[model samples]
Target: MSVSVRTRALTAADGTLSHRYMALRSLMKICVKRRSVVTFLALFTLSVVLINTIPLLPKETMRLPPRDLKGSTSKRLPAGTPSTLLDLPPPLNGHKNKLFSGSSAIPFKQPLSHSVKAPVTSQAAKTLNSSNSTRLCQQKCIRDGGGHASVAVGEAEMTQQTVREVSGEETAHERKPDSFWKRRSHSFAGKESIPRDRMRGEKSDLCQISVGKWNETTPESLPWLSAGDVRKMAFLSGGVVLSKARVPGHGQVLQVGLGAGEAEAEAEAVLDHRQHCQSGSCALIKRPSDWFEVLAFHLDRVLELNRSLPSVLRNFKSKLLPYRYISGNARPVVWWDPDIQHLAEVDNDQNSFSLSWPLYQKVLQSRCGARVSLNATPCVGVQHSEWGRLALFDFLLQVNDRLDRYCCGFRPDPSDICLENLLHVKCKSPNDLLLVHILVRRADPSRLVFIDNAGRPHHPHDNLNFRLVEGIDEFPERAVSILRSGCLESMLLRSLSADRELWESRGGAEGLRPIIRTIQQRGTILLQHIQNRILRLNKDL
Candidate 1:
């Protein structure tokens, strides 16, 4: 019985051992499947502990790689450190700072804290803590440059401040810079803003050419200098007269032969035996005041008007000229260009056309010669821009002989040709008034040649001929800009100095000051008018 009992117990014990071994094998298989998850959790816990403990370590142990390393790396300032505006880091010796990479950002050694006392705004604080600091540096650098490279720091700051003020004014609609470059500074401003490529070295415009001191080989400028060629003067034989009317000193200008049988190349000498007067008018045909013509020519060239005929004051021996109009005094000789196309005597006055004042206004509105059109009623073969140019030239120097020959713009003196000829009486019927001295060259049909430019320099300012600019809405941007530039005086003086005869006749610099001052005053008034018009246009828009 004991043996049977012991065998049963042993069987039970063996069964228990088999079940335990099987359970152990299952547990080992489960552990092998979850081994990766267990390892990941262990690593994550380790990292959390390390991250929390890092701030407790000494700063010396947090040192970055050596500064000599070529690799790109940013060295951030310690937390809670105070940094002033524009306080830049020292430049790395051999490596480019990632902050200023690929940019011309100027890093000032001085900080903004030295000058600016305002507390840093929240936006600036955010910028300091972020990468936006790089952009801020770039903008500051551009401001320092003053739209040009290598500007001095002191000047750059002043220029930058001025630019900001100008920008503020623009935003307020007070005024705006006419040019893109002008927004940064005024010194580089231009009327017809030249392209960057074209602005290299210096502008090659007519104004620029008029600059520089003159030498003997080149007196005044090209085309104005007569090359000192001697010629023979003679009266037209057979008692022939070009016109029925007789002018001041000489009834008619004597034709001087430039070369044998070259009648086409012959130029006319306007004889004036009277003592040279600085101001006042002459006869209807010629200027009795010879100095005025010479002054007008220089003024024309200096202003880059390029409209008046080239005239020079030359002293003539009484014997050299025709005996009929003998004068030993200096006279202006005008180039009688064959290229000019003169109107017939039947066309109103022999020197001009029969267009009435109302018709003139209509023509300006039509914009003649701008483009080809079937309608020819308003097309006068003259460019639309030419009228604006003419108005501006006439307003300055107060030359009213062309546009306001009837003395309609201002009060005329008793001795004035317009009043003496009863021309002002025609102003009552302005629609019947005719235009004169509006000459143009056959070669350039669209441009006008300004002749008989007898400017009234002594005209009273209160009596300025505003009627000259009556129908004109737009002026040449280049001319208007020049008027506003304040350089007109200097430029005119430089150009006029080249003409030895004209310069000396006016008694040099001191004598020329008054005339220049008058022109400048008129320029200021015109500029104000232009600004008002521009503002009016903007409001209409």
Candidate 2:
């Protein structure tokens, strides 16, 4: 019996061991079958973990190489190098620009009568220098927050390709050298040294033609709340001196709110000629106490037009405004704030393009359906919006010196003007050109205040009848009915109020009749002109 038990135990052990061996063999077979997929998954997980663990690095900053004004744009100058566009004549054939690429010109201003010389390299540089001068200036302007900027593109690599989706008739150019910047835009591009009179400094003892004797009072005493208040305050104050009411072309632009170097851009207009004024033109201190400015404001207000920029005639003096006319032809030149004259041009892209006053004039002069670009979007020059209303404003005021005028001081050519005439402008997009109702949505309201209402001819025939406005006919009754009304005298007198003698050479009430009559006669002529234009338009259509 003991022998039988031992034999049974040994057999059971052998059977159990055989079962374990079979299970282990089956597991090995399963592992071998799925090995490829498992191995792939393991490798993928490892890669993902590694990728997640690695830190992302910041973008590397690229410092622009110094400029080589010589035809070659690729070469870099040594550190701390000083160079200028005037250093080398621009190549006769346009070269690559450092800041702007492609063949587009960076627009600059020339006085209305002045034609700037295209003397640089007769060849324009295709590439803009990113570091040193023009390019740097553009970059700085863009960084000012309200300005626009573009990515630096190399001209050698870019060819002009028309994008079809831009709509309308025109395609945008990239500040091309061939079209816009025929001449260097820098303030010092053509010359050197910012002479003192040409310099934008403060004036003291501003020359004033005081009509009545009054105690001296501070400019702060003047309330800018309304036209009457402003005139009243200016009248109560002693006649302070006014000085240097001259710009390159228009002598009417007087300095008021801003002083020399108040803004870096303003300083540049003084220091460099190429740095165009923020406004294509400069600011002026217009005298509404003369009431022409107030008259304009009142007319626009009653007419519900856009010509008024809130103005106050205040007697103030600055160090730069130190010229006091003791005698002679010096009249108290009117003073207005160019700063608050909410008229800024919407230059889409060309760094301060609207500042190129004459260039835009050329654009305006282009046929009615002319097209341009702002922010790479195609913007057509149609006679349908606020731009058209400006013509009416100019027509009413008899303003001859619009953008172009003969300049004075150092750069005395008609191409240049004193910094005071430099306008304050901002950029606009093609999107801003909506229906007149939505025009204010995407665009800044163009309060084109015609502060330079000085020197308007007493008779309209001298100004209104001879020259015609561009888009005058297209404006509707809402825009023009005020010009035709009999209430113009009331409007003028209302604005003049207690300071009625200031309107004309102090003949008191009798002096006002002819001026009012002249305005009424001009209104009749303006209506005739508009009717004629509409009739002609019907014929053309």
Candidate 3:
């Protein structure tokens, strides 16, 4: 029975073993069919284990002290060292840096006119001398409180280079030569030596001149002329046909008079016209746009009380005159004064008395007519009061050709005859600076006869020829009072209105107002300058 039970158990064990072997065989077949996928999974698992085992950062680097996000300082970057070495986390600094808040520390560019040397800061100086690259300097600046100091450093470097170039330290190849006008403009010192207003008024008519009908002739148009001068201008304009168009020595004036055919007519001309023009009954004609002469005459009568030539606006064509002199535009006509004494163009110095910059200054100091002294020399002929009047008048009209013939008072462009003719170069030696257009009459040597009354109406107020009044320690009290009256505009308007031609030529009162305003503003500046000068003199006394 035991043997039989053993056999059965063995049989059962064999059957169970055979069933397990069959199951293992079936599983092996299935694994063989998907062997590629199973191999890929095993390889992936091995790679992941290898990756997990390795370290990204060095042990010492990873063991850094934890930063205090709440409030604590970290190691600062060394001076002249790059801040980009370490990756910066979000700016955990509690306070926001105003400079870095989407704004540059300093403007990158500035106008050349207003540009000045950039002030060197200690930090910028250090950066300049540092051997590090510019990027390193920029990074170091950024780390210092995030002030955005990089821009300042860059600007300083650029400005220093520019200064070096301007100072002639740079090679000539690096710089181009400046123009004559540019050099003169820069030499002006921007601010006038005399005091001026800080805030200027509107510049609507600062350098503007009026244009009008050239043929407009009426009593209203010739307002600047007296009843007598008016008749002379009318006669010169149209009453009689002109003959003999000859050029005068001093100016572009054309001398015109009756032909031989009309010589009898000249003697029989209107008795009043003959009385108005006694000097051979001739007239000098100027260009149509030469309104400056007319303006000067009116200003002489109204402001300085100086004796200027009588000029009137008139327009009339004559076959005898050259076409260049006749633009069909109304031109200025002045009565010929044959008796007036003046130096001929042949003389080296055209003025009756020769004067230079240093000489003029010495004459002003001598106070010639005020106190008699044998040493007065050239100052003897000129009246002490007359100098003040001349200086005041020249300053108002900015007639630099007379006193400041070298254009030392203001910046002169190539358009100016003084600069164009290279006369300004003589200003380098003040002793050699000679005065021109200083006129006097044969009848009276005491007073000055202003012949070339063509004033520059468009001269800028800022660039006014103040050098005309440089040596004048005193100004005419009457002229000062007139400027101070505050009615200068009204007085000018009223006086200008008398000349119907000038009034209508300048677009009437509307066009005249702007020019009048510019003059008024200049008057205000002159008043201030006078007051300051008086105070200074009083202090010195």
Off by over 4 Å in 3: 1-242, 248-251, 258-280, 344-350, 373-375, 535-541
Q: What is the lDDT of candidate 3?
A: 0.51
**In model 2, which regions exceed 4 Å deviation?**
1-294, 310-383, 403-447, 459-467, 471-473, 498-505, 535-541
Candidate 1 global CA lDDT score: 0.47
lDDT (C-alpha) at residue 438 in model 3: 74
**Steric clash pairs (candidate 3):** 214-330, 220-500, 221-500, 221-501, 222-501, 223-498, 223-499, 223-500, 224-499
Reference-based TM-score, model 2: 0.35
Q: Write down the lDDT that model 2 would get.
A: 0.34
Question: Which RMSD values do the candidates have, in order?
Answer: 26.9, 25.0, 26.6
lDDT of 2 by residue, 202-254 (tens): 00001111112222222222221244434433432333322234543335445
Clash count, candidate 3 = 9
Candidate 1: pairs in clash? none
Poorest lDDT segment (10 consecutive residues) of candidate 2: 198-207
Quote each prediction's TM-score.
0.52, 0.35, 0.53
- lDDT tens digits by residue: candidate 1, 32-61: 868978989889999999988877642111
